[model samples]
Target: MDAPDTAPGTPQAESLEVLYQSPGLPRWRLPPALAALYGSDLGFTEPCLYANFVASLDGVVALGPEYRHSGSTISGREPADRFTMGLLRACADAVVIGAGTLRASPRHHWTPQHVHPSGAADFAELRRRRGRAADPELVVVTARGALPADHPALQTGALVITTATVAAHLRSSLPASCTILAAGQGPALSMREVLDAVHNRGHRVLLTEGGPYLVGQFIAGGLLDELFLTTAPVLAGRIDAARPGLIAGQEFLPALRHPASLASVRRHASYLFLRYQFHRSITDASDILP
Candidate 1:
């Protein structure tokens, strides 16, 4: 599919068409002015975790060997997608990403303004109104403490969640501005422990921009509450072994399938934005049967 015109000022002022929305779900649409979309309407009373990703029409999240940042290949740096990512970051108290994701985007700063510069002022206003920090705290999960220490995001100071062994290893390597949270005793970090640590810091709205494997851990632990997925019209046919789908390195058995309810859908030219809310009972790990 051909990409829509992404001229400097046109996309930020265009409204996305709402082709279909689930019944009783919010009827919100992306405003032309890039004003806060669904501002403060989420009503998240406690720590709620949500993830966002862009994938090809055939469900491939990454294009192997072609792009360093897989998401860029899928979305092709679409303006609407960037705006939506910014809006989600504006609503979040923290933006969680894996060490691999941080390594992929060397220049990315997990802030709303960084992705959507046109809506910088609006994003700041939203944060101010919500009484959030100047920028969402960057939460980087790494079990082995292996990270790109010189990356820009790390230089900006982030919360590195990892195992105790990794924390000790990172103490002398990571930037002084970075803080470490030992979420596990050994090599593996538990998703539940990471969420507890995040919640302890008073972050109620958490947003994750994952690199598939990390997302798989959240799914396995039943910690993912919602997902915001952008389906680009193009097909990225992947025959390589390295390419991955939305969820990787994990599989749900037939009896353990976790179904998600369609929350909303919006269209921008040929692209489709989808919001899916997973069943609460299934997402709570304690409620799941072995």
Candidate 2:
């Protein structure tokens, strides 16, 4: 079904231009509701993990305390970016995010309909066709279990992947609707365990919308497979020590320079959408094994 342009001032999807795509990348038109925003289908297979993020031209993902959500600030609540996010969520089995990301957007719901209300029915139909749940399961990862229990997203129910110690602390704090998974015994949570827990729950197509630190852990553990980044045209210059880039709390400079190959590129106006697939060497693959 085609999603009409019901929202005023929202950019149409037909405006998007495909610049480049890898040789073997699958290509197909999206459903009518999403076709305007996303021209091609993102035919992701099961047991895959991908991350999505938006940053400014100055490589700043967060604008410190001055801006509530650096992404919204950087993208200026661009309709194309939101549509892309919604489209990704629509194609995923589950939506994952760090606790920091949950706290950052108090009113945000990590669902396709929340971002693109016009495509709500279309998203539902897509989920039905894929044999997925009506809404993608929300998975929140926290090492310390420090989360806003009363947040609307938690109220709707979520799987809290955390450490055993933190899980006990959160048992009574979080609503009964929220299920806590003790992915680790110690004070820290393991990225591998988190993926295992999600995979065990039958969510093989995982999409992580991170807060940098979580993305860094996924990269550090060599668990990340692909990265879908939206480069906003604005330049959010860093004026303080708090502004962060795409990856935080981890360095991959000299020892772990993870290499990735460009998979696809698209553009809408001044915004650029890029997809990079991480190239995992045999050595890196063995390092992540149990």
List TM-scores for all candidates, in order.
0.88, 0.91
Off by over 4 Å in 2: 1-14, 26-29, 282-290
**Model 2 steric clash pairs:** 13-36, 13-37
Root mean square deviation (Cα) for candidate 2: 4.2
List pairs with backbone clashes in candidate 1. none
Task: Give the whole-model CA lDDT for all candidates, comma-separated.
Answer: 0.75, 0.78
Question: Residue by residue across 1-290, what tens digits does model 1's lDDT show?
Answer: 11112235534524556666565643323343554333213334345788898989998887663467677667878878887887888888999988777777777789887777788887787777778888999999888677988988899899998888879989899999999989888656778888899989899899999678887888877788889899998888856467788877776776578889887788777988888988655553431111
lDDT of 2 by residue, 144-168 (tens): 7779999888999999998888899
Ten contiguous residues with the weakest lDDT in model 2 = 281-290
What's the residue-level lDDT of 250 in candidate 2?
76
| Predicted model with the maximum lDDT | 2
Give each prediction's root-mean-square deviation over alpha carbons: 4.4, 4.2
The superposed Cα distance between candidate 1 and the true structure at residue 164, in angstroms, equals 0.7
